[model samples]
Target: MPVTYIPPEQRKGILESPILQMAMQQRMQQQERQFRERELKLKEQEMPVKNLIQMGNLAKSLSDLGLDPRVILGTKA
Candidate 1:
């Protein structure tokens, strides 16, 4: 006896077209707009964080030197 193979038919909802592609593009644009707004807000607050780091380094040097705080920041005459 020989074996016979027959392919099955695809259902109606199995494939997507151009309309679905356009909907995905719109969703991506909305997400990108929200991300850029948040990035701008974060950049505005970064300056204070940089100032704190500079101050921390100065404090460490002052404690290690065993000298007056004014002498560390002053230039040699």
Candidate 2:
């Protein structure tokens, strides 16, 4: 492929164009918003698993102390 060299003035004009700047800003904002939404969704999905792990650890600790978790929590086997 032949590389075409653009003049410095044209390059500057293109880079400094307001329309291009606004488009770039909008795209970046949209990408950031999408990233935040995905991050929140992942955290939401992880919450139940985290709660279950915490419950298991608590139960284990209780059993180590000779406490019956099922009875204390009134959960069915």
RMSD of 1: 11.4
TM-score of each: 0.44, 0.80
Model 1, residue 40: C-alpha shift (Å)? 4.2
* Segments of candidate 2 deviating more than 4 angstroms: 1-9
Q: In model 2, what are the clashing residue pairs, if there are any? A: none
Predictions in order: lDDT? 0.73, 0.93
Scored against the true structure, residue 21 in model 1 reaches a CA lDDT of: 68
Taking all chains together, the TM-score of candidate 1 against the true structure is 0.44
lDDT of 1 by residue, 1-77 (tens): 99665444542333355676678888899999999999988988997898879866886788678865456766334
lDDT digits (tens) for residues 8-32 of candidate 2: 8789888889999999999999999
State the lDDT at 22 in candidate 1. Answer: 78
Using TM-score, give the best candidate's number. Answer: 2
- By summed lDDT, the worst window of 10 consecutive residues in model 2 runs over 68-77
